[model samples]
Target: MPVRYLIVDDEEPGRINLRLALADYPDWQLVAECDGNAAARAALARHDVDVIFLDVQMPGETGLVLARELACLCEPPLIVFVTAFSAHAVDAFEVHALDYLLKPLDDTRLAHAVERAAAMLRQRQREAYGAALRDYAVAGAAPYPERIGVRSVGRIEQVVVDEILWMEAAGNYVELHLPARTVLHRITLNRLEALLDPARFLRVHRGAIVRRDQIASLATGGEGSHRLALRCGGVVPVSGSYLAALKAAMAF
Candidate 1:
């Protein structure tokens, strides 16, 4: 199967150049292109992109800030920072699924990054499968994972589960949202739900699970649903499918 990719750069020339370079690899497909961080995020929401070739410098939101936000995505795309910046910026990317290519991306370097991304994506699939099996086998397993592991930059980061404000599903992974950081964990929401304390966390939507105490307000969301406003100012959508559970939790 061809790997779907996204290109995000403020400069039309940069986007064009990347497009031309990517054409050499027939196995990779360009699914979308965005001019800024907001556009890139919107594109991601509308399409399933496996990799993102991003520019670090832009007018409004820089690529580094966008990368941090992307890190929180459930199944974040492989982020390749296509920038002219020096190696110092490498530190910021070290905590997420990322690669860096100095300005004027080379075919050889791009090929190497693509190869590594393929291996990472494959490993992610295996991890998701194993997680589902483990979840099915354990009915009431205690002692859940103390630290959730997430890939960042070029290393694995362990995030404390207790600090997570909520979790949301994104494709094959889970987004663990914290007060200060969002970690993209390579695990299914179903598999993760089993490990959390039921009393503290509640499934508010098929794609979302939030800490009970973290909810700030629950209001009619229109269309027979509820919108849970969090203390952090992020609102989570609650579908009718989970309305009963959400209401019951609020009553507690």
Candidate 2:
């Protein structure tokens, strides 16, 4: 059987271009094309694709978010992130994505990714699977809530995980929101999500995660999108990519 592949990108042109490039591979089957994370999730749930060509930046749910979920699947497809952002290469490798392709993707790179996917699919070892995940966990360095250390001015301050209200990404640094005050921490949202307990801190957006108890309300935005109104009077826009999980988390 040919290797089944799924192409996921928010841009119609990118998707079409990838499809056109892949047309040269007689052994590859274009199983599906998803415009965003929601469609990709639905297709993954219903199909038996062997690999995915995923775009990192989208309007709502990021390619990374979908990759995390796919990692939990019984037989997850090989992930080759297709994105314009080269800055996330380290993060992508850390997440154990098969390959990272830049925008205006080249046929040579696509072929290389396909070849890597083939090699990975043929591997018989399961031990290496957990190793990649372990590396990824460390690569995406998220602070452990039970024991989090923050830097306030020139002093190293420690804050318990449970006391956190929410976190926001500010360039290379993160703003840690607490009940009494907000503190600045040097961490990426991707790394932070890996450390925090998912049950306690729900990622409502690409750059924000709120403690479940800190959410004030979920207000509907125009179209099918939603926004999370925090207890601190801050609103976090929920992407359509993550709306399903967010709704399930809130039992809405």
Report the lDDT of model 2 for residue 23.
90
Tell how far residue 226 is off in model 1, in angstroms.
68
Query: TM-score for all predictions?
Result: 0.49, 0.52
**Best of the candidates, TM-score:** 2
For 120-210, candidate 2 gives per-residue lDDT tens digits of 5666322344344333434456533354544322223456678888888898677888888988875578866776778788887888888
Which portions of model 1 miss their true places by more than 4 Å? Answer: 94-97, 125-252
Candidate 2 Cα errors over 4 Å, as ranges: 87-97, 125-134, 143-252
- Specify the poorest-scoring 10-residue window by lDDT in model 1: 131-140
Pairs that collide, model 1:
93-153, 94-152, 94-153, 95-152, 95-153, 96-152, 96-153
lDDT of 1 by residue, 188-217 (tens): 687677666687788989899998888777
